[model samples]
Target: MQWIEIVVLALIQGLTEFLPVSSSAHLLLVPLFTDWPDQGLAFDIAVHFGSLLAVIFYFRDDLIKLTRAWVGSIVGSGMNQEARLGWAIIWATVPVGIAGLLAKGIIETSMRSGYFMGYSLIMFGLLLGYADWRYQRKFSANPASANSDEYHLSKTQIAVIGFSQALALIPGTSRSGITITAALLMGVNREASARFSFLLSIPVIVLATMLQSVELVAEPLPVGWGKLLAATAISALSAYLCIRVFLALIRRIGMQPFVLYRLLLGAYLLYCFY
Candidate 1:
């Protein structure tokens, strides 16, 4: 791949990976817009692997606590808040894992059409907007309402959010967007929802990378490793920056901007595709 192509695709993958915007949508649209060659599954895996690193490093401290707590709970040690939270992340990832496995073939073929992207973008975007609106109203009525001790998600609520994440299997549905929308719909505070969405991404991304790694192993070797490494580094940096800025903005802005952006993007896709 060319330098510019590598840079643009890497940045796009990294930047949108954490955002409510769907990175898969952006990637699929790239060739449509620019007529670039298929970056291939190997490149996709590399860039996503970079994003995994970004999330891991960004949440290193939290991961340590969660890991320790989770391990403790496994050996009959008393489960604490962190341990329970750890388990919550695990449970939340299961639905998507299974869905992705069952639907992977169909998703990569028939589901790749722009028609699917347009509808999913608009539908899920509206859902996200509604959730944010409701969240704002509740927050206005009772400041720190979501912060109340009783506001944490129950098991049923977690299950609901987990199942909703499977919707992100569609190209434009956006894993983070769907998960955050689920959190907001369940009355989770914006910051907390964003945090949980990011946490939930760990296992999902790891699983995706593992699957792609198997494919990468079977493909040609040593041909593009240098370019792949460079792209991975770029993706990591971009993802890290996006996570930091998104967390900061989400706390204050409450996702209105993203909702608007999604609506506009969805509309454009509909016009272009249909």
Candidate 2:
């Protein structure tokens, strides 16, 4: 890939990965508008790995605490808030993992059309907007409780969010978007929901990267390592900044902007394709 393609794709991947906006939807538009060649599997893996790095690094401190607490509970130290949350993350990832394995082929083949993606973008955008609206209305009367604690979520709530994440297998549904929508629907506050969504991403990204790595190993495509490294660095820096800024501003801005953007983009796509 050219330097321009490398930079643009990397930045897009990083910026959209954690946002409610669908990164896959945005990336699909690249080749449609430009004459750029497909950003082969190697490059795809590199950028995602960079995103994985950003989330992991940003949550390093929390991960350390969670890891220790989780191990402690396993060895008979008993459960605490951190350990309990650790287990919740694990259980929450299971549904998406199974769904990906079972339905990935069908999703990639049947759901790659612009019409399908456009419909998904619009439909899910509305769902996200509704979820955000519900959250705001329920908490507007209680400003002090606007940032409710997520650790107190019931098992049913976690399972609902987890199962909802499987819907993200559709090209434009967006894993982060669906998970956040589910959390908001379950009455989680914006900040708490965003935090849990980001934490939940750690395992999901790892799983995606591993699956892609296996494919890359089997095909063994010739790749430009230098370009891949550059993509990784660019993606990592942008993703890290995105996480910091999003966490800082989500409580104030809410999800309306992203929802509106998705709607407009989806409409444009439908106009062009259907």
Candidate 3:
């Protein structure tokens, strides 16, 4: 890959990985539009690993606290809020993991069509907008309530969000977007919704990266080590910055901008593909 392709693909992966916009869709569309050859399995693994590293690094402190609390509760210590939150992430990840395993073949085959992705982008964009609007209404009526105990969630609520996250398997139904939409519909505050969505990403990315790594090892593709290293470093830096800025401004700006962007992108895809 040329330096330009490396930079563009890496930037797209890093920037869109956490955003409500679908990173998978962007990655799929880029080569199609640019007429570039596929970036191959090795490149895919590198960029995804970069994203995983970014999220883990950004939330290092929270992960430490959650890890200790979760382990403590498992050892018969009384469950506390942190422990519960930790358990929430674990339980919430199950549905998507199962869905991925069961639907992997279909998702990799039929669901990659541009038309399907276009419709998914529109459908989920509208859902995200509705959820965001609902959250704003609730926040307006009870401002103080929005900020109080943001991460506190009931088991049923976590399960609901977990199941909703499985929708992300579709080409354009972004993982972060779907999860955040479910959380918002459940009345989680913006910051909390985003935080949980991001935290929820850790395990999924790890699993995906591991699976791709195994595939790459089995096939043993000739990889450009220099390009792979550059992709990883560039993607990591961009992803970390994206996370920091997103968390900082999510409350102030809300999800409307992303929704609008998704809608426009979806429409364009539909027009082009059809």
Q: lDDT per model, in order?
A: 0.88, 0.91, 0.90
Greater TM-score among 2 and 3 belongs to 2
**Which model, 2 or 3, shows the larger lDDT?**
2
For candidate 2, the TM-score is 0.97
Model 2 alpha-carbon drift over 4 Å, by segment: 144-147
Off by over 4 Å in 1: 148-151
- What tens-digit string does per-residue lDDT give for candidate 3 at 222-255? 7799999999988988999999999999999999
lDDT tens digits, residue span 95-141, model 2: 99999999999998999988888999999999999999988888887
Models 1 onward score TM values of: 0.96, 0.97, 0.97
* lDDT for 75 (candidate 3): 96
- What is the per-residue lDDT of model 1 for residues 1-274, given as tens digits with 9 covering 90 to 100? 8999999999999999999978877876787779788888888888998999999999999999989999999998898888888889888889999999999999989888877898888889999999999999999999867782212567976898899999889889999999899888888888888888998999999998998888888987665889999999999999999999998888778888888988888888888889
Q: Tell me, what's the RMSD of every candidate?
A: 1.6, 1.0, 1.2
- The better candidate by TM-score, 1 or 3, is 3
- What is the number of backbone collisions in each predicted candidate, taken in the order shown? 0, 0, 0
